[model samples]
Target: MSGPVDAELARVVRDHAGRLAASLVHLVGDFSAAEDLVQEAIEAAVRTWPVEGIPERPDAWLYTVARRRGLDVLRREKRHREKLTGVSWPTEPEPDDRLRLIFTCCHPALPRAAQVALTLRVVCGLTTAQIAKALVVRESAVARRITRAKQKISDAAIPYRIPGPDELPARLDEVLTVIYLLFNEGYLSSGGDRAQSRDLTDDAEFLAALLHRLMPTEPEVAGLLSLIRLHRARAAARFDENDEIVQLQRQDRSLWDHAAIAEAGRSIARAASYRRPGPYQLQAAIAACHAEAPSWEDTDWTQIAVLYDMLVHLAASPVTALHRAIALRYVQGPAEALAAVDELESSLAEYHLWHATRAELLRELGRRDDAQQADARALALTANPAERSLLRERLNWT
Candidate 1:
């Protein structure tokens, strides 16, 4: 492929693959087959785009290829054609294609782990490795969960549409998990060379907003949307002019969008009025503490730590524990936080942030050599370019 065509094709695929896959699944009536059709569409682009030049409407072009291929596959299978006889090629995009796909993937027939893994793969365009990292599980486990979930969908004939109102609550948590992880990937990107991808965050926020509109009384939806907006409000201050990671303590508060923060505050207040606090609301409350702070030193660590404690009681996980340890550092001191972080080594040893947090605490305790070694482990474990750069600077390797 020529350089320009290759670059453009990559961008198109990165930005639209999830939506394209969602549409194809709707047309094909099979999750696994839709994914294969998407791959075939990409392969077709690889073969033709360089020769023909990238299409003026690359996403549309890919969708057209995938749709035609899906029809061909159904025709070849013969018996399946009867099942989809009423389906026709859509003249315009469905506004909720991705959301419907997420709901389908999160059907209660599937296990919670499978629901999360499959939705992250097909609805959020996350790779198995990325999903594994997000879930703190093995990559092989994530792949198997995705495969089994797809098979279960096919066997059970799960309809590729949003659930009716009564069924929505049953599947809401899994859908929210997928969207939260999607936003996290965008906020600090796990797989790509770039530090962050605004496109992923924008997609996540769009989905959350759609969910909020669909379930206006759902506090967790409001909480998730508020959490995302709070982070986005400070996005401009996350990196320096050279695009190096800027620690939150050192970021220029003037760069933050105060109006956006205010809007998110109202969202949190709205969520609280529901009087049904959940993990997401607690997490958003914690983020609100950070976003509302006048400076890092003025951060309400006591309140943040209390919120984390509530979160742990509601939904404990290794990642949550690690975050709580950071808050503990600010609340109690390095000694106490180190003990908490140390207890998580067995559970989160493979997680880069675990080592990174340990390094911070070790540095604070005057264990310079141990701190350097922990930072080295973090550097080795992570593929994220920005994180690797930050770790290198910490180790004085830059």
Candidate 2:
């Protein structure tokens, strides 16, 4: 409740809630019960942290408290205590356990919407109200969806263990989907002035690293890790000294993390060694083409266009088509790219990036008036402060 304690509480929720919930799930083998225990531990923090001062290891402290609470609940339930007794006390779960936890939370057995909502709540540490706001649904609707997801997990008796090697491929895709969405939400950011959330991006990178360690032979895992590292290597340059969006061509190369870029290169090589390429591998290859290039004009757009062509075949989405069009600009010229953009107009009409890309292509064609209108539409559709600022600056260009 006090200022310092409140900030600490927020930090703990954002940073450690998922790990704590993962530990509890392993111990209690119940989704709803573990979640409740974590909430109780947080509430206890609110009351006690202010009085006792924050502990040295806040996450460890929360985990200990929540585990104790979960045990108490199991004992008090009388009937469930038999089930709980069979469940051995979980030792400290490794970082990879959180991946398993999220995979289970987003299990394909659940409805797709519930999978996303539950993953955001239990694994991403988003409050129901926050999830509701992000999802543009009523708070109560989000609450019920999460509740239903928990019920499904409980009823279906979804085990809280990572998939075996045989099942890893299928389950890994679900885990990657959750992490990809989490990272993108932080990378471009959904609706904030800050271009990225360090917490979400860092968490995503951590998950990717854990996945890589657990399944080093999996090409897709290596690809996803490389993709994340490549983007993170440019995190510093994405925003300017004023925290505004910096166009890729204008970003200071000196500010980019060359070390991270090198690591990404290594990851890409690891992925290639597997020789079973996936969408993430193709996407990372495109990112590598940019990372290796010295300047925008010097970038190997042809190679990137080829990779995007591969990516489009692997995962044919409007977003991928839009990105492929961007790469087409250098390989086939702006007219070709503009035609590609126009083809997606109906599908991505409300998508801000579609209009933004259209504006760029139109600008190249000397249609300044049409470009300005496209830029305005982009600025109108997006709520992200960084994006809006970039569009406004583009619109003001002569």
Candidate 3:
């Protein structure tokens, strides 16, 4: 049903869709219209590229087609005609279109929920289904939120540019949220063929670094950068040679990047110097606790639990609570942690990690059948290959 050309096109689209959409939005000044132009260009490619073979610069070809279509739309609508004269085919030294677009989407005028949904959709190139899973909501709810958010952007005529210095602080929280979610998606990958995607994580790190460069005084930006680096430093130890998930406590400490971990520690110190504590800063501190530990048994669970307590005070959510419960498992005991986790069941019944965590606690409590059932539920809910493999092994189904 498909050919090499189709496969190549898919790969190109998958790799460059966010950059292309950002460029189109920059040209057309409409998020929804830019997306429509991209779809139209993709359709045109589907029809033409098969016969012509792939272009030497397929991304450029798609952008050219989409730009021309956007121009035509502008002419027909007779709106933003001024943008028509200023727009040209992009060349080298182009602005950071994706970053600018992220700021635009994270405007304070829009609801915070809509801001994150739109950025994840338009800037991160996540599908509605993927975003729904990440947000722990129904697909229909995600679709509606995205549609309304786009409409609100169009209606409000939000400028497609980065906010000024005076505006950055007001918009920083949502922007940080979007980037954090982007990194989280890459770290564990809510749903996809791969267990993880370095591309998404790399993109998030690049964006965070750029933000740090732009606002050097912003501690939260540094905190976020540190958080990402700390996680990436330990990434190599997260999986074994068999590609199965390796629990943090059981991972080889030798595989960890000590230099990067130390560098991240300095970043946390820098963020702390600002004395403007926030959720990201606290999270980075928690991650630093793990990264700085010489051994699993050397881990300072008390400090981690205290940090989680502070994080909960700043940003309370079911997921955050679940994570706090996990830290408590070491500080307190499995039974206490089990009680905390059980309270979240009604809220996190569909979440794979929640089930997986419960299985661990149940096993600790010597409830064999309950642990098996929970592991089975976790395997059913998750699409991640590594996690599924780990769960299967735990259930002795390997």
Top TM-score model: 2
Pairs in steric clash, model 1: none
lDDT of 1 at 303: 96
- Stretch of 10 with least lDDT, candidate 1: 190-199
Candidates ranked, most accurate by TM-score first: 2, 1, 3
Q: Can you give the TM-score per candidate against the true fold?
A: 0.71, 0.83, 0.70
Of 1 and 2, the candidate ahead on lDDT is 1
Q: What's the lDDT of the predicted structure labeled candidate 2?
A: 0.78
The positional error of residue 156 in candidate 3, measured at the CA in angstroms, is 3.8
lDDT of each: 0.78, 0.78, 0.78
Ranking by lDDT: 1, 3, 2
Total backbone collisions, model 2? 0
> Any runs in candidate 2 off by more than 4 Å, and if so which?
1-23, 42-54, 57-60, 79-90, 93-99, 111-113, 120-142, 159-168, 190-198
Total backbone collisions for each predicted model: 0, 0, 0
Residue 393, candidate 3: C-alpha displacement in angstroms = 1.4
Worst 10 residues of 2 by lDDT: 190-199
